[model samples]
Target: MENSTQITIENIQYSLSDIEKDCWSRLVNGAVKSRSPFHTPAVATFGQKEISLRTVVLRKTIPETREIRFHTDVRSRKWAELLSNPAISALFYDASTRIQLRLNGLASLHQHNDITNDAWQKTTLSSRRCYLTLHSPSSFSDIPTSGLTEDIEQENLSFEESEIGLKNFGIVSIHVQSIDWLWLHHAGHRRAFFDYTDGKYQWMIP
Candidate 1:
C-alpha cells in the first residue's frame, strides 16, 4: 500500500528530505547551462549608450571554472556594452512555478577558435538558419513589397559552414559572483542567495 499521510511544518507542506533541496540546486544549475533554446533566460541590462537587453540562451556552464556562456551577434548593441564593460546581470522568472532568479556576473566574449569551433559544431541546421538572415540586427530600413523565404532544408549546411554568421556570432560568458533565488509558496515565501566568491554560503535576509 502507498503511504497516505498529511504532514506539515510551519504550515508548509514538503517532503522532509535534504536530497530534494540538493537536487533542486543541481537542476537549477543545469538549466543555467542548458543548450536548448527553451532553457535560456531573457537577459536584461542597464542602458548606457543605449538600452541593451535581449533574450539569450544558456550555451554552457563550467562549474570547475565558474563560468556561464551565451551567444549574440557582434553587431548587436549588447555586444558593444560587453566590450566596454563586462559586468552584466540576468533575470529569470518561471510563471508556472512562481520562481525567480537574479544573477550578476562579469562577462567575457569568446573569439573563434578551437573552443568556439566545438560549441558551434553542436548547433542544429534549423538553429543555424537563424544566422543566415541579414547581418544588420537592429538596423532601420524600408522593406520592399515583395518578400522571400529560403528553403533551409536544401541548404545542407554544417554548423561550421555558417562562417559569415560565425564571424559575427559572439559568445558572451558570465562568471557568476552571486545569484538571488526567490520562490513564492502558497503558505509563505522562500528566498535564498548563493555567493560563489567565498567558500561558504549564508542565507540572506529576504
Candidate 2:
C-alpha cells in the first residue's frame, strides 16, 4: 500500500516544520496511552546475509536522549544478532491515525548491569514469565507452546520463583539516529525526516 505524510488530529492541522517536536511528543504519548498492537513495533536487525525482524513491546521512550527501550531474553536470536551488529531499525504504524514512524538507531544491550537491574525492578512478575521458559527462545520443540515448563505456567509466581528468570532478562536500548515520519490523508500526504546525528529536520515528498 502507498504511504501518506500529514498529521490531522481533532480539528487541528500541523505541518512538518511546525510540528517536529510535537510529532515526537505525540509518538511518545501514543506509546504510553495506546494499548493497540501497533504499540508493539517491529524491530529489524542485520544478520550475516539478511535482515531479521521481530515485533517487540515498547517499554520506554526517552525523547531527551532520543532513545527507545525494550526487554528481551538474553538467549534470543535477536539479542545475539544485536551483540554482533548494533545497527537496527524499528517500524511503528498506527492504523487508527494512519501514521507511520520509521526509526533508525544503534542498539545497545544491557545485562547483569545497573541499567538492566533498574528496569527489572520496575518489571512486573507477570511480564517476567517468558524469561522463565525451560528452553531458549526459538529452540526446536515437538509441541507448540510458550516453551515455559509446566510448573511455571501459572500466571503468578513467588518473587523467589521469578528470580530465576531475571538472569535471562535483558534490556535493549536503541539510540535513535533518525526518524522518518509519514502521515496519510485523503487530501494529501505529508512526510518529514529528523536526523539527530546531524541535527537536521526537514519535510520531503511522500
Candidate 3:
C-alpha cells in the first residue's frame, strides 16, 4: 500500500509577493547548484509539425529582467524552432515541496555574441563536446551515433580542439511573460497565476 502520510513542512504564511520572490530565489539556486531540483527544467518550443519538448539545464536567471537562460546547439531543431517562433514554455517542479512552476515566455537565441561567449567560457571541454557533433540534432543515419567524432566523444580532444565546438554553441534567453504556480497539500491544493505582460495576478482554482 502507498504511504497515506502527508509531508509536514515548517510553519510560515506566505503572501503572493513572498511566493513570487521565493520562486525567483529558487530559480537562481537552480542555475548554480547541480543538486537543486530546479537545476534541470523542461523547455517547450513550437516545432515544424508539433510542439517540441526537451529537458534543458538551467543556466542562469535574471530576476530584474524576468529572464532565464539555457544553452544549446545552434544546429539543433530547437534552435531553428525558436528562430521561427520564439514562443516557449518552461516547467519546474520540486517533488519534496510539492510545488510546480509553469512559465510562458518568449525565447531569443544568442550566438557569436557576448552572451554566448560568456556562457561558452564557463563550460568545460567535456560539456562542449556535444557541440562537436558532425551533424545537427535528429539527423537520420544508417547507424546510431552520438554525432561526435570518436576522439571528441571519448574526451581525447584538447582545449584547442574543443574550441571548434564553440561555432555550434549558443544560448537561449527567455523573457518570462507569465507564471502559473501550483502547490499540493493533503488539506487542500492552492494555485496562483501571475501575468507580467498584463501586469496582474490572481488566485486560481487548483
- Report how far off residue 171 is in candidate 2 (Å): 0.6
Superposed model 3: Cα runs more than 4 Å off:
1-9
* lDDT string, candidate 2, 113-172, tens digits: 999998888888788898998889989988788887666776656877798888999999
Q: What lDDT is reached at residue 84 by model 3?
A: 93
Clashes (backbone N, CA, C under 3 Å), per candidate, total: 0, 6, 0
TM-score of each: 0.72, 0.89, 0.94
By lDDT, the candidates rank as: 3, 2, 1
lDDT of 3 by residue, 1-206 (tens): 11222212356666677677888999999999999999999999998789999999999999999999999999999999999999999999999999999999999889998888888888998899889888888899999789888877789988887898899999999999999989898887878888999987777889
Comparing candidate 2 with candidate 3, which one achieves the higher lDDT?
Answer: 3
lDDT value, candidate 2, whole model = 0.83
Q: Kindly list the per-residue Cα lDDT of model 1 for residues 56-89, writing each as its tens digit.
A: 7776666556666777767777877778877788
Location of the lowest summed lDDT over 10 successive residues in candidate 1: 1-10
Candidate 3 colliding pairs:
none
CA RMSD per model (angstroms): 6.0, 3.7, 4.6
